[model samples]
Target: MKGKLRPVGSPVPFPRISERQELPWAALYHTEFMGSGTEALSLAVAIAIRRHSQVSTPEVIIPAYGCPDLVSAIIAQGAKPVLVDLLPNGPHMNDVGVRGATTPSTVAVVGVGFLGIPERLEELSGICREHNLLLIEDSAQCFPPASASKPHADLVVLSFGRGKPINLMGGGALLVRTDLAGQAEEAVAQYPVSVLKVGMKWLIKRLLFNLLMRRLPYYVLERMPLLGIGETSFHRLDTISRLDLPESVLQAGLRDFQRRPLIHQRYDTELAGLEAWGWKCLASDRSEMSRNDPQQPVPLLRYPVLAPSKDMRDRALAVLNSEGIGASAFYGRTLPQIEGVEAAVGGRDYPVASDFASRLLTLPTHEGVTSADVTLIGRILFSVAES
Candidate 1:
């Protein structure tokens, strides 16, 4: 097991994106590029805070089962994060839970499309309007990415980091609706420009990264604890820096974004019958009103599914991971369970969120996932369930 070939859990694959991808967004919103997705979100949080200046100790509503980055972004703006439990056995927050969490200090609701499945942004938009709160679409994990053409939220955040739909090594963007353009622009104006360059050195690192992502090297790399191969931790967004887009990387990212659907489809088609064995494919449950159009299958950072029970999920994860399938129990805990999050967001019992976290499993959907890989993953996952 130790020496078997295994794909890297997350890989930075080279791809291309065309300028045409930005055309619809440019016409509908004010776009700004930043150093990372977390920075982009921090800035958006700042704008939301500014919009509610009259409220002291502003608060933002976020789902309980999500990246610690959400908490970090909210805290960076000197605001409080009000954790809302996710929908029973689903990725997004329960609409009722969000409504209950809102109070006078609540400034915004961050709707996350977890693992490439779009959140019910339209529903959240209506809720925001009713509550006079802003809606921020965190599109860090989904693709075709979020666009302004059918604007459902007041602002959008995108990440081009490792494992993201469009991995540009490091970069992120914020798309502000027309109404909030002034506030977003004002915030960007004060930020210092990033001096990062994507020259030969950066290219070499990317090349090396892709090389190491291959199964043979990744198998060795994953065992080296010092490398933190797939660790997720909270990093404070100290400052938002403006970055100049590298055309080559941006184009490549766009192209990679385009190629994702095929990989996603492979997973869907291969795992189609697993539901009979107690596996729940999240893609099948997407809301028709979600950002992802029914006609277009967007690439999710990973294909998320819910195992029948906590015991089964753990067993499946152990088996899949041991086989070097890159299957993971993402986050593996709700926000309150994370190291420092309970202190920031306060300790509260989120039963649904806890249950969702325990049962959730995510499989690699990157360009590196081959059809044979998909078949092997399905076989192993099914075997785990049967056993």
Candidate 2:
């Protein structure tokens, strides 16, 4: 698999912290660093809600088709998750579904920008304000230009996890609105800084993943659950522990963040080539969102496309995998269907989320993938579709 185009994310480099104080988006809002995206989100939820005796079970609205970590974070904060379905054939949450899900117990709503595609944030922010609910932007996958203005959400969360836009292997940041900064600062003070051993472990893991992912070695390693390579499973609420972001990891992320412009440009050119071949993407292009400037490009983590059915998606993956072209089926199941999350979601049926999960396939757009690789992938995909 030496020549394979690895699906999703680029390799993370080792930390070299030239100037920690000048990291991107540092001055935009009050920032707090954590060990993982899940910790940052859990901390934000805890800071947002006011515990009341009248409201025994607080709830937060999240997209039905999202990372299981979102649900875990809410549960960790002692709040129930209210799942809302996505729009038909789109990654953004349905506005109507979000509004309908809001109730007296709903204290907040989280809008997740899946796969570097921005969600309908302005609209979602307006709805949250009208209902007196806090709005949290999970921009783990979406990384805008470093010089751009901050998003409209009350709290913004960014992930530097293994497959995210800025891959530092393990780190996250939470930016709170001016009004909530004081409270957020106070809330996070209690958590301890991450240990040096953990940071070392993360660095080792990062090196290993970069070397083996999308390779034949990874295909064999991923099957072993203990190795934790591309394995999806539910994490318990108790596992959401708070730890500070290591300085080494922070420096590594800053270096990667600085390279966004070049990455975004490459993605734009390759994505256009694929689109010219008449393939439809799962999420809307960045240019489609109002906040995104047509002149400035935002890099996508992967190029996601929709297959006609689950069988087609599986067949496509098989063909691509055999040819050393890394194509993947992302989120094999919807949020509520994940093991141990059903009780938290009340076992609601989300038709749109279910359908989207079954049909979605993501292709590589990392620096390692070339324009010629996209043409080859396009040919494979076209063949799979015609069959």
Candidate 3:
């Protein structure tokens, strides 16, 4: 039976121009805005290998259980992607896997901080330096704290997609280390702004997403596969192109970025409530920042959990849908397991990634969700887990 609907993620509230604020990191790094995270990644790869003297095929190492866009971005730059497996608890790449995957052709390694928890970038950076490879940090879901130290990566990418850390419906940014600023700018100069038609399409998509992401509409629309709401598919590399970020989206992203502290508080409250109810989250508190100060809060893009098994996860999703709570099996499969992608990228052994993919589920931690909603969600999760 259908129940009350609570979405796992919420659209950022429309921005108040009066609230526009400056971002600290903006001043620390050389930043360039792009249409999406994929564009930023593609540009980063281009910059990283533009002057390489290697005669062998250029390759970029990526997490095995990541969004296909990561692979597509590398392929778009005329480079191949070498996939590495994740640590057992996931979404951090395994050090051994990354070390083993590095080939002479490897030009860079992308360290992804899945679901807002930063990866072991310091360790990865040391490895990259040892191998003379560039380290690119994919913080699409993470918004670093203003007071925190900069990441050890040579380049960092941020996204402002519909559900990203700084959602503005559509936009992304590349934060290049000063040393690579010149080359990065050169690569960015090659791409032209998206044509009027593409801009219009993005505008339309933004409007539609804001409208349908709500409870009632999402419940009905989500079941309609033709609409493709929340559906995942492998897109072609050729189709990846740079688009202009609408002025409003830029303003909204800046405003939202500044407001991250408040959002982090809400997530902390919700997460604590869930933990109190005996629900285990996928993200561990032992991350770099937490280990430094256990009392410090870590902001999340979504609160992810790993069910006992795929069947249990599916049953929980069914219950959450019927109850009108937004819950999802995020990235139902790992990178290589994604349909239509294996043929394009070639296959690799990734048992740990495949298993992690099957069990992961996410709950909403957005501003639209309330403490009462969180309590109910905890109860729902507890009930499902027991069942």
| Candidate that scores best on lDDT | 1
RMSD of 1: 2.6
Name the runs in model 1 displaced over 4 angstroms.
1-24, 287-294
How much is the lDDT of residue 357 in candidate 3? 85
Question: RMSD per prediction, one decimal?
Answer: 2.6, 3.4, 3.9
Candidate 2 lDDT over 252-328, as tens digits, reads 66566556434434434544544444446654445433224545455677777877778888998999878877777
Cα lDDT tens digits, model 3, 182-275, are: 7677677887777323355656776787777666676787777787766678886564346655455566655655454434454445456454
Sort by TM-score, best first: 1, 2, 3
**How do the predictions measure up, each by TM-score?**
0.92, 0.87, 0.86
lDDT of each: 0.79, 0.73, 0.72
Q: Per-residue alpha-carbon lDDT of model 1 for 1-387, expressed as tens digits?
A: 334334222556554444545434666777788899988888888888888889999999999889999999889889999999887778878999898989999999999978777888888998999999989999888654454547888889989887676777788988888777876677678787786577678879989977777777787888899988777676776777878886666766665555544566787788888999988998777642222345655656677889999999999888887777888888989888888888898788899999988998888876667777788889988888888
Model 2 residue 137 CA deviation (Å) reads 0.4
lDDT of 2: 0.73
Candidate structures ordered by lDDT, highest first: 1, 2, 3
Give every collision pair in model 3: 3-322, 4-323, 4-324, 5-324, 6-324, 6-325, 6-326, 7-326, 8-326, 8-364
Model 3: ten consecutive residues of lowest lDDT: 286-295
What TM-score quantifies how close candidate 3 is to the native fold? 0.86
